[model samples]
Target: MASTPAPTSRRRTGATRERQSTHEGFLVHKSGRWIKISAALAAALILLYIFVPLPPHHFGSSWLGYTLGTVGALLILWLTALGMRKRAITPGRWSLKAWTSAHVWLGVLLIVIGTLHSGFAFGWNVHTLAWALMMIVIVSGIFGVTAYATLPRALSANRYDAEGAITEKQMVEALRSLDRQLHDAAQPLDRECAILVDHSLEQDPFTGSIINRLTGRYPGDATREAASELRRLRAHRPRVADDPLDKVDALLTRKEAMLARLRRHLRIKGWLQAWLYVHVPMTFALIAALSAHIVSVFFYW
Candidate 1:
């Protein structure tokens, strides 16, 4: 005779299952605590901006304006430290996940803080330049956040097939295997057909412009063109069993399918990386403009 499990054991097993099923993305880390804090900070700044009296033209001279400017500057510096934090992984209250959540929400808070600090002043000066650059950095950050949150699922889906998930190395090996098979299969093909197959084999799968990678459009794809031309030539030939062109055509079609999956993987991976090229450079530029703005203000005052 066997004994049944206790009720407490059953409840514990269910709880463990529940925990395993719940996934917490960076956006919703700690149940969106950072989002709530950011909202509160922005609201406080807005209230201060409304209640505190200042000269109509006061942009940086007033105490409140200077205070807001200081806060915004410190926030920008802290947000920029996230890149450094990524290299050193740690756990606890200030984990990387919490840092990222705060980075995103607090970076958004800058729009209100910077605007209030400027006092609605705009002109053809370094002050305005800093503001514009800040806007660009924030916008690019938003795009990056969106990409990270969404595109990862797409990348994962791209790697999966009926059998299992394919790794990058496996993708490369699969293509090489297909190319070798193609090489052997093309031997009995006619001279013109052989040339086309050779072109497909020799062409590099990874060579493409950034635009082509991001857009997943390779207009001059050698493999695709070769497959199309072979099919066209095959159309005019009478149907025959074990024809060499038939084997070659089928191999080309498989290679095309593999190439498409590889390119899609590259496209998603490219999108994941492309935003940093704009965001990182613009961040440094913003810092430079901010330094100039600060210097000119104190120099004149």
Candidate 2:
């Protein structure tokens, strides 16, 4: 007679299945399965390169070198396929998450494969240029990984205030509303004070270069200058109840606060997107260089 499994064992199996089915972030998808595979493969290749007896001078033309070169070229083609995969939405086994996990880890694996293929011979040639471009793409990818990991939290924290979370559209609207209030409040102010308020009101909210977005520094920010000037002038004047300048000053201060948050949002958003500009174009360039490298190697070299 056979014994039946206990309920607890059955429950454990069910729990394991449930956990496995639950999706995780691509980096840790399948409990870092792709990472482990890449690491193991890289280690194996390095060991083979070091221990497999072959003359150093002839290594690039050796069987192992040809194999590594073929694998690397094919891997690059597959990695590029990720861009196409992103267009379709699907689930299970070869899901976008799994594809992305493979893309990142296999992309990393190319470093070892490409270096071993070159057999450490470097020069000012198409081969070296292709390798350099690959390196740039990898480094840019690393930057993208870091940005995606950290920036979302910073964006979330920046958006939340006493009231609740604010959207990008809300942030812009808040600035516009404050500007309207400032315009009305400045009606009774003397020309000098009114001019200060106008400097802020007439200024465009979105006027800044890429450098300004990245660094979050706007030296010529009219709002900041207006607020500072209003404070300096107010410090010298006599205090009065409900003075128009006081209201205008308050509005300016509020507008300044809003602008700070809005710029922070823009800065964080820029950082998140900046890497793709380099990574994508450089990838195409790498492919072009890689094709030239292959042609030279097989037909010309």
lDDT of each: 0.92, 0.91
Write model 1 residue lDDT over 233-287, tens digit each, in one string: 9899998888999889899999999999999999999999999999999999999
Off by over 4 Å in 2: 1-23
Candidate 2 residues 30-132, lDDT tens each?
Answer: 8899999999999999999999997879577789998999999899989989999999979888999899999999999999999999999999989899999
The candidate that wins on lDDT is: 1
Please give the lDDT score at residue 198 for candidate 2: 91
TM-score per prediction, in order, is 0.92, 0.92
Q: What's the lDDT of the predicted structure labeled candidate 2?
A: 0.91
Give the total clashing residue pairs for model 2. 0
